[model samples]
Target: MQKEVLIHVRGLQMMDAQGDQEPIEIIVPGQYYFRNGSHYLRYEELLDETAEPTINYIKVSGTGLEVSKKGLVNVHMVFEQGKKNMTYYTTPYGTLQMGISATNLELTESEENLQIKADYALDMNEEHVADCYLAIQVQPRDCKDFVL
Candidate 1:
C-alpha cells in the first residue's frame, strides 16, 4: 500500500564566484511505519547495494499516485551535486544517531496515468542499524508558491 506525503520547501539561494544557485529547503513530515505484530511502530527503511549511487543525497518524492505532472511533485534532498564521492551525511544524529544517505532520487512518468514512482538509495554503514528513515507521504493540497 502507498500514501501521499506533504512536503514543505523554503527557498534558499547559495552564491559563489562561479554563479548563484537557488535551492529549496525541504521540511518533510515523515509518515512511514513498520509493524512488529502487537504494536505498529515507526520504522526505518534502507536501500541495498543493488541500486547504483554516484552522489550522496537526501531525497523525497511522490508515490504511485502522481504521474506526468511537472511541478506537481518534488524530489528534494541535499548533496554536493558536482563533486564525485562527496558524502552528503555521515552519522550526524544529534540525540539519535544515524545517517541516511539518499542518492539516485528520481521521479518520472510511467505508462499509467497519474501514477508515479520514486526511486532512491540509503547509505547504511552497518548491517543491523537503527531505523532513522522518516518518510511520510500525504494527500495533496494548495500551498503558497515561490520562485527563485
Candidate 2:
C-alpha cells in the first residue's frame, strides 16, 4: 500500500437478543498509512457526543487486528481468529474488563489496496455484550504532493 491512502470502515452491531437481528451500521472515512509490517488507519471518533474527539487507530495484520482509542474514551483491544483476548477498556467514568473472541478473520491485499473482514463476539466484565462484524478497506490515494 501507499504511504497516503483512503480508508473506509464499516461496522455492524446486532442490537437484539431475540432471533430478529437489528444491525446498526456505521461508516467512517479516514487516512491510512503503513509502517514496518502493520497497517494503520487513523480516524476521529465523534459518535459519542464527547467534548473532545477521540483519536482512533485500527492496526491490522495477517493474523488479527488491534484497535486503540485515545481521548474521551480510551481502550486497547485485540482480536484474533479462534482466540480470546482480555483487555481493559478505560473511559471517563471508569475502567471495565473487555473480552473479545473472533469467529472469523479474512485478509486480502495487493500493491495498492487491502481489505479485512472479521466477525467477533464481545464481552464486557464477563457478560456477553454483542456479536459484531467489522470490515475495513484501504486504497491508495492519488496525491500530487504526498510521496509514498
Worst 10 residues of 2 by lDDT: 139-148
Pick by TM-score: which candidate is best? 2
Error of 2 at 25 (Å): 4.8
State, as a TM-score between 0 and 1, how close model 2 is to the true structure: 0.80
Poorly placed runs, candidate 1 (over 4 Å): 1-94, 108-148
Query: Which pairs clash in model 1?
Result: 4-137, 4-138, 5-137, 5-138, 31-135, 31-136
Candidate lDDT (C-alpha), each: 0.26, 0.78
Give candidate 1's root-mean-square deviation (CA, Å). Answer: 16.2
Q: Output the lDDT of residue 145, model 1.
A: 39
User: Residue by residue across 16-108, what tens digits does model 2's lDDT show?
Assistant: 476345454444457777788878888777747747888888888876899999988888889999999999988878999989999998888
User: Candidate 2, 63: how far from true, in Å?
Assistant: 3.2
